[model samples]
Target chain A: MKVSAIITLKKDVLDPQGKVIHQALDGMGFENINEVRQGKYFEIDVNENDPSKAKAIVEDMCKKLLANLVIENFKIIGTQ
Target chain B: MKSSVITFPGSNCDRDMDVALKKFGFNNKMVWHDDNELPKSDLVVLPGGFSYGDYLRCGSMASKSRIMQSVIDFAKSGGLIMGICNGFQILVETGLVPGVLLRNKYLEFICKNVFVKLDNKENAYFKNINKDILEFHIAHNEGNYFCTKDQLKEIEDNNQIAIYYCNSEGKIQDQYNPNGSIKNIAGIFNKKKNVLGMMPHPERMIDQSLSGEDGSIFFKNLINNIK
Candidate 1:
């Protein structure tokens, strides 16, 4: 099974890196850019076929390693 | 007392902390960041430096190192842990210590010896140190300590405010609040008071009139309390 995890800063948290990128894009004359929010994507290969088990494992990984629950949020998607 | 200083790739103050601990008759060792096992020591010191090149936010990468798991485990078992400057950032990143360290509001690297008034003398780390002004050096860009209003109040009410930046008169001046740290807090302790993380470099001020010796008392008091 293949799983993809997308992690992003929580809505209320400040994203300094994203802001810097937004500024750079503006400097480059890309006027259409309104805001830029940065996120991390991870692709994982899990041997388990059960969607519930896979979701549980991904959630554990996010809680323990992939995301900082204090300031970030994460979502996991997989082929059921 | 037995102490070990964890050295990351970019840590420049490991030797200084080792020397300070040795001067206080401590059996000190330098543990590498990649090592998962901690030395059999009473205390663990994460000294300051640009760990992981200060990339991905200060201390963010270093917190994910292999050694942090063991450090976190040791801390959970009630062992003493102290993180200074970059180390403090690492502590926050690892979630071993509460709160976050943001970039200096002025966005400039601050390097100077500043006065910190000891707000809590009951901890082992501050026992011998007077509940008054002590000078220590701080050099970092991401040293501003921040927390939510309610969390700040909870920390203050719990006596976790270990040290506060102050002026020559030992008063916390609003304008002189270096780094825009909330409550002018320079250091804080975990709920159990066993873990301490501060931005000031106590190891740099161990020698009086030389390195500005007021900081040495921190080590002395910690060792004495452990014994």
Candidate 2:
């Protein structure tokens, strides 16, 4: 099974990189950009074939490595 | 005292910290990030550098190193831990310290000797140190510390605010709050008060005439109290 984890900073936290990107977009004459936030996406290939087990494993991985629970959130998506 | 300083691949301040510890009569060892076990240490110091090249974010990658697992365990066992500069960022990334470090408000790297006021005297790291202004060097781009308003309140109420940026006159003014850190916090102690992380480098200022030497009191206090 292949899983994807989308990790983003928690809503309440400030995203300086995102803010810089937003300013850059404005400088390029791009409009309609209400807000800009940055995140990371990780794709992992798991050996398990069961959907439930894969989900659990990926969630564990997110908590352990992919996401910092103190300041970030992560969601897992996959097909088994 | 038995102490060890963890050195990531890019760590440049490990020697400075080691020298400071040795000057304070500590038998210090340098533990690499790849090692799974920390030296039997009463105090563990994480020296500053661009760990893992600050990949993904400052201190983000280094927090996942093999050594941090042991550091976390050591911290859980009530061992004293101190992170300076990049070390501070790693502490937050590893969740050993609370809050996050964002880029400097000016969007540029800052390196200079700044005044820091010792706020918490009860901590072992600050024991016997009078509440006064100490000069230390800070060199980093991502050093702005942030947390929620309620979290700040809790930290204040718990007496975890360890250090604050101050001026030559020893006044903690909003303008002197380097990097726009919330509550002007320059350093903080964990809930247990055994772990401490700060942006200023005490190791860089151990000699009074050279680096103002006032910073030596921090190490002297640690050596005297941690035993």
Candidate 3:
């Protein structure tokens, strides 16, 4: 099974890279942008045959390694 | 005294740390990350470097290296452990130390000599040190320390803050904060005070001619404290 997850910084944590990207976009004539926050995406292929099992495995990886729970949140977006 | 310095694949400062420890009279052993056991020692150091090529996150991959389990055990046993720069990042990733080092506020790599004030001197790493403020070298891209409000409160309540970025006069202010770390925190210790994680590299400042002697002072005092 294949599972995808997104890891984002907590709301209160500063995202300077995202802010810089937003500024760059603004300089490029983009408008109506409220804010920008950068995040990480991971695609994992688990050995499990079931989607739920794959998601659970990825969730475990997120908690243990992929996402630093202190500053980041992880969401398993898809399992196939 | 005996000391061990763990060398992860991408660790560049392991040799420097070994040199510094040896110069200070420690029988320093270089331990590989793949090793399953730590050497008998009074001190264990995670030296600064771009471990695992800074993949996924700085220090994230290295934190899971085999030797870390032994390092964690050593810390749990109240043995002294110190992590410098990337080593500090590894400590946070291992959850042996609280909080995380975020990307620099300006998203630029910082490399320079900055002053740091010892916040608490009751621990083996800093106890009986002669100076309250010392100039140390800091070079990292992700040294901006951050923690949740609750964790901050707990760290403060326990006096876990070990040092703060400050000026030569020991004035701690936002202006002197090099990396935008909260409260200008430059270093921290675990509740037991045996585990220390800091962004500054004392090994870089060990020699007066090459750099400065503040690190020499630190090493000399550290070995004595251990004894």
Q: Rate the local accuracy (lDDT) of all candidates.
A: 0.85, 0.87, 0.95
After superposition, the stretches of candidate 3 with alpha carbons farther than 4 Å from their true spots are none
Residue B10 error, candidate 1, Å: 1.6
Give DockQ: model 3. Answer: 0.96
DockQ scores of the candidates: 0.18, 0.38, 0.96
RMSD of 2: 2.3
- What overall lDDT, based on C-alpha atoms, would model 2 receive against the true structure? 0.87
Comparing candidate 1 with candidate 2, which one achieves the higher DockQ?
2
Give the Å error, residue B165, model 2: 1.6
**What fraction of the native alpha-carbon contacts across the interface, defined at 8 angstroms, is recovered by model 2?**
0.29
Q: How close to the true structure is residue B8 of candidate 2, measured as C-alpha lDDT?
A: 94
> Distance (Å) between predicted and true CA of B151, model 2?
2.8
Tens-digit lDDT string for candidate 1 (B52-100): 8987568888898999999999999999999999899899888877888
TM-score of every candidate's chain A: 0.87, 0.92, 0.97
Off by over 4 Å in 2: A77-80, B208-210
Model 1 Cα RMSD, Å?
3.5
Locate the minimum summed-lDDT window of 10 residues in model 2 chain B: B123-132
Q: Give the per-residue lDDT digits (tens) of candidate 2, residues B1-227.
A: 89999999888999999999999899999999999899899899999999888887789888989999999999998889999999999998887878888878767799998998888788788877764778889998988888777778888889998899999888898989778788788899889998999999999989876767776877887788877
